[model samples]
Target: MGHRSVADLMTPTAITVRRATTFKEVARLLKEFDITAVPVIDEAGHPVGVVSEADLLRPRPTGGAATAEQLMTSPAVTARLEWSVVRAARVMQRHGVKRLPVVDTDGRVAGVLSRSDLIQLFLRPDHAIREEILEDVLTRTLTLAPSAITVDVEDGLVTLSGTVPRPELLPVVKRLCHGVDGVVTVDSRLTCDSADRT
Candidate 1:
């Protein structure tokens, strides 16, 4: 099965701020784009930090017009283009961040992956999900006949029926089906033809 990578969902063109950019400018960009945060980049287009709405909201010690370098969270949390959506989400959760500045192989700022980007995976079409379950899981992985399993998908939920060669393969079917990008849950009513113990 082809799982979606961060590159598939991230905004290819990201709005960024420079280290010396004024606080007002960062706030304006955020509001103009209707985004909660923007990545701070260097002259080479390498991300140095991220300036967020919360960063802008926090009162500064100078109580004057500050710059993005002063307001941004440093040692920027980032993601790579090839990272799996699941891996990107775990990184974001581990860092307690809503967005990640996406970098290229050479480490230049390419785009930005947000919580919304990750959520889009679950929005894939139901037909695609069904195809993956039937082709990738049952047919390819388990080498089961096309007629051996019946896969039904409604919204993001998957229901697997029919019979498998062994009882163990039933759970494997449910698991691999659930692992598909758009799947929300698995309702397996599969039976086993083999007289194996449960």
Candidate 2:
């Protein structure tokens, strides 16, 4: 299966805040929006940082007087719309963040992506995985007829069996199938024509 992009799962029209937004308002927004954090945008609507619940709850010198600009984690860790969900997960893990501000080409806040969103899309059904391997891996990638190979998927595991035109390409097919999302394992049961088996 093709990699799902962040844009496919992100929540567009995310609630955002300005740098001058007060601490109390930030807290209120988090509660009202049911979000853990919000991007602090500049006048041009570009995110400069994010203010999460932890940042707001920690003791501060300014206390009640503090604003989002003073408390936010600066130079925000962001994700692009085109990034694969796998790559986005790595970024979130690297930063130890529960959510990321999705940014457009101009660096403006396009949406918000949460851990749940990635997890929901990561686990695909066995039938969908089978179709991709048969349609993409076999027909398009290997340039073989659909009838040339038989693909079976069960519980995220794929089994491939048939007489391949090029025995040398079996390894390539296995690798591609393994790369597909939700493919837990691959079982190769392929052989080649006797004359080509040298």
Candidate 3:
């Protein structure tokens, strides 16, 4: 399958905070929305910075009333609507960030993308579970030659059918498929040439 764009997966309705907002207010927003972070927007409604839970947890100096401007991280790492989710994941990992702002062509914030959002995209029960199961199988068991096999999942049951050069791969594939989350049973019919069989 082709890569999905960040905009396709991003939550367009995002909560935002101003630079002058108080830490107390920021904390309230997070708690009220059950969110981990919020975009810091300027007067023009452009994202200029970001504030996360970790930033708010940092100890403050005595008698100091920290503003969002003082606690926010600037020069934000943002994603374009056209960017692939893979690229967004790389950017988040590179910056050690949990979320990224999705920006429009004009550099205005359009949405938010978070680690939890990405995780839920694949793991959500509302989506076809097969895709998630197949992905898990490919990543965990067939790391070296994952493309050699095909996986089909339906209602928690997995049916793996494909050909691998090594006969020993069949049982390994079965074990891997069985190990995936939401996989209840594995029906593996993988085959290998006689010469490759052990």
Clashing pairs in 2: none
The candidate with the higher lDDT, 2 or 3, is 2
Worst 10 residues of 1 by lDDT: 189-198
The TM-score measured for candidate 1 stands at 0.80
Better of 1 and 3 by lDDT: 1
User: Model 3, poorest ten-residue lDDT window?
Assistant: 120-129
RMSD of each: 3.4, 3.0, 8.1
Per-model TM-score, in order, reads 0.80, 0.80, 0.63
Model 1 CA deviation exceeding 4 Å by range: 125-128, 135-143, 165-179, 185-198
Instruction: Encode model 2's per-residue lDDT on 77-183: one tens digit a residue.
Output: 99999998889999999999888999999989999999998777647898899888988888888788879788998888899888777768888888888878877
Instruction: Kindly list the per-residue Cα lDDT of model 3 for residues 1-198, writing each as its tens digit.
Output: 334688878989568988989988989999999888899988877888898999898887821478888888887889999997868988999998999988998888899999987775455352355665456556644564556667776666778777777778778777765545445578888888567444
Off by over 4 Å in 3: 62-64, 124-198
- What local lDDT does model 2 show for residue 151? 90
Off by over 4 Å in 2: 139-163, 184-198
Q: In model 3, what is the error at residue 158, expressed in angstroms? A: 12
Question: Candidate 1 lDDT, tens digit per residue, 27-97?
Answer: 89999999899999999999999999999989888544899999999989999999988889999999999
